[model samples]
Target chain A: EADIYQTPRYLVIGTGKKITLECSQTMGHDKMYWYQQDPGMELHLIHYSYGVNSTEKGDLSSESTVSRIRTEHFPLTLESARPSHTSQYLCASSGTRSSNYGYTFGSGTRLTVV
Target chain B: AQTVTQSQPEMSVQEAETVTLSCTYDTSESDYYLFWYKQPPSRQMILVIRQEAYKQQNATENRFSVNFQKAAKSFSLKISDSQLGDAAMYFCALRQGAQKLVFGQGTRLTINP
Candidate 1:
């Protein structure tokens, strides 16, 4: 298994609450990604980081923001949680530079806002 | 943007039989990468196989192999002697260089007893 780890495997929070999804990797990979996937569906790239202090939004329009402070950790935060934010968040890391360098994905955090 | 298409929404095969999942991608770039990922009920995305566009020879790993046709823009996976463990949702994805991946909606594979 990849050394990538994501905290809060599942989250259920009230609307208007602030939330942070934590992702970490011990492999010292230069690339990190966050994907949002609904139940049994395609994975949508929400955010990605090339390295520390560099983050970019993916093709999908996402309200969440991400920061890459340290090489090992990339955390995503939401200002205010909403029902539209409810979905499975997957954190992944790639060790190599190949376009298809097979991302090592976490078990994922299934979030439900009510 | 590169786009991947998996025409089959669902597929099934008897245990010990062979099954194939189809995938096609659209890309103007000559160099790129292709991948097939297996997501079980656990929801962890596991890479089943990959093929580089530069390579003409197909890539194979154990019972899993990819039929990559760069000219035709097709990449498919064939599973031989399918097992119960092979049941999962399969995603076909495309990537340009070392960038983000574009994935298909996925195909659910069932291994019938």
Candidate 2:
């Protein structure tokens, strides 16, 4: 079955630790996105990509950065994690946001910085 | 930029009953799309249904349906014959033409015994 995957369902780390959140999809979608959400809040888009090697910052400015070296993979990284960076990171891909189908999301990575 | 709003912080429905969760949005563009996504306790965001701006008829999936009042900028979800599995957080999302989606604060649905 085609699906999106994220690694380390939950993570807890100390401040200043380098962390990477992995995201991959079996579907050959060209558009991929990264979103951050606090508990019970609206998800905020932090980064997005149109295709391989193409990435753009999203509506919400984020300290983390993302890279799209392959169509199926988009990874987000924090050079130095902080308590303020603790949140749920969600990965999604879509054919087109304008299309009726909308986006397919992963289970997400819940990070806690202590 | 588009914005979505889900006024109800939470809602409850008895098994086999029906419940509706309200959603509203603000957008300058005339053409857009609306979606209802379900996030279960497992934390997977699943698409429940979608509606196109050009379509006058509302969208439905099994026990799930939408009441889309485009002129009023309101899109609400109606779940019929609610089951325990229907208990989840539902998010209302809006997309303008071909951009990233704007999501509302979710509405947590609790199915009571």
Candidate 3:
């Protein structure tokens, strides 16, 4: 079935290490988003892309950046990861007419920066 | 700007019983959409139900249903026949036009057997 996927479900790294979280969706949706969520807390949008080559920062300030190189792929990168950057990263995609169905989300990547 | 709120941080219900999760939002736009998403432990978040602001009728999916009071800026989820699988984090979300979706603090639902 067509669904969104996130790689490296759990990751632990030393502080200052550079890393990239992979996100891909096979649903051919035009809108993709990245959200940061602390355990048992509300999710906050960090980045979003309307389509290929289009990206924008979200409401919450984030040190990470994202790029939409392809319709199905939206990856987030951190130049130097910090303990504060550690959290669950969720990827979601929505179709052009998403009012009816809303968004489809990936399992999420839990990163731990020590 | 829009804001979504889930007053209840957590809720509990007995198996095979019914429970309601409250949600309220503030938006100036008349035309918009409301949705309830469920995130199970270590699992992906999935849309449980959606409601269009213009639709007067409530939205329902199987044992999941929504009580939408557009005028009052309220949208609540009602789960019937609660199951163990229903125990999860439930989030209320809102989207207006091309704006980004806003999410409320999730309510963790616990189903007691």
Candidate 4:
């Protein structure tokens, strides 16, 4: 069983449509991250949150936006989806600095824009 | 800034044999952690092993072990008696204190029957 869950395991939308990718963790981790990965490639961090109401853009620049209203929930939204937005989005959560479990990742969401 | 690098894009090993995947990272921080994660076709990222930067002893788990050289900034994963199930895309990640995790370009491992 997965402690972290991402809804809409797969999504396809028309260009210019707005979509929200939902990620929730049951572990109550203080750190949550959203990573964008292309097929057969590396993961690029697009957004991250240290705690509630604290979100920051990652090393990779993305048009998407994220929010951390609660400790367990971090959702990424694209105001206008485009063909370039097609890729897999992975959600991960981790404990505090002292915790050594690393990051627990969700199965990931495959997004396609037509 | 932190960066992880996996030199090999793909590696193949015969069943029951051993294979090693190489990873190197660049980081200025002394207090950090390293991890190896495996992602199968299902796309679920599974934690394979972890190593703390301060630990001198290498970390091992069952058929998997990591050669963590803090001085060299290299962390390699060695899989003993490789099984068909072991075939997957393996990623090397690094995380500094209270910082986001950095991932390398994954290496696809193939287990030959």
Candidate 4: lDDT over CA atoms?
0.93
**Candidate 4 residue B29 C-alpha distance from true site, Å:** 2.3
Judged by DockQ relative to the true structure, which candidate is superior, 1 or 2?
2
What RMSD does each model have against the real structure? 1.5, 1.6, 1.0, 1.4
User: Which segments of model 2 are wrong by more than 4 Å?
Assistant: A96-98
On the 0 to 100 scale, the lDDT of residue B100 in model 1 is: 75
Give the number of the best model, judged by lDDT: 3
Considering DockQ, where higher is better, how would the candidates rank from best to worst?
Answer: 3, 2, 4, 1
**After superposing candidate 1, which stretches have Cα over 4 Å from the reference?**
A96-100
Name the 10 consecutive residues with the lowest summed lDDT in model 1 chain A: A95-104
Clashing residue pairs in candidate 1 (N, C-alpha, C atoms within 3 angstroms): none
lDDT of 3 at B75: 100
Evaluate model 1: give its TM-score. 0.94
Per-residue lDDT of model 4, residues B18-77, tens digit only = 999999999999999999999988678989999999999999999999999888999999
Residue range B1-113, candidate 1, lDDT tens digits: 67889999999999999999999999999988898999888667888888888999999999999998888999999999999999999999888877777899999999999
Q: Please give the ranking of all candidate structures by lDDT, highest first, separated by commas.
A: 3, 4, 2, 1
Write one digit per residue (lDDT tens) for candidate 3, span A1-114: 999999989999999999999999999999999999997768999999999999999989999999998999999999999999989999999888764578899999999999
Question: Global CA lDDT of candidate 1, please?
Answer: 0.89
TM-score of chain B of 2: 0.97
The worst-scoring run of ten residues by lDDT in candidate 4 chain B lies at B94-103
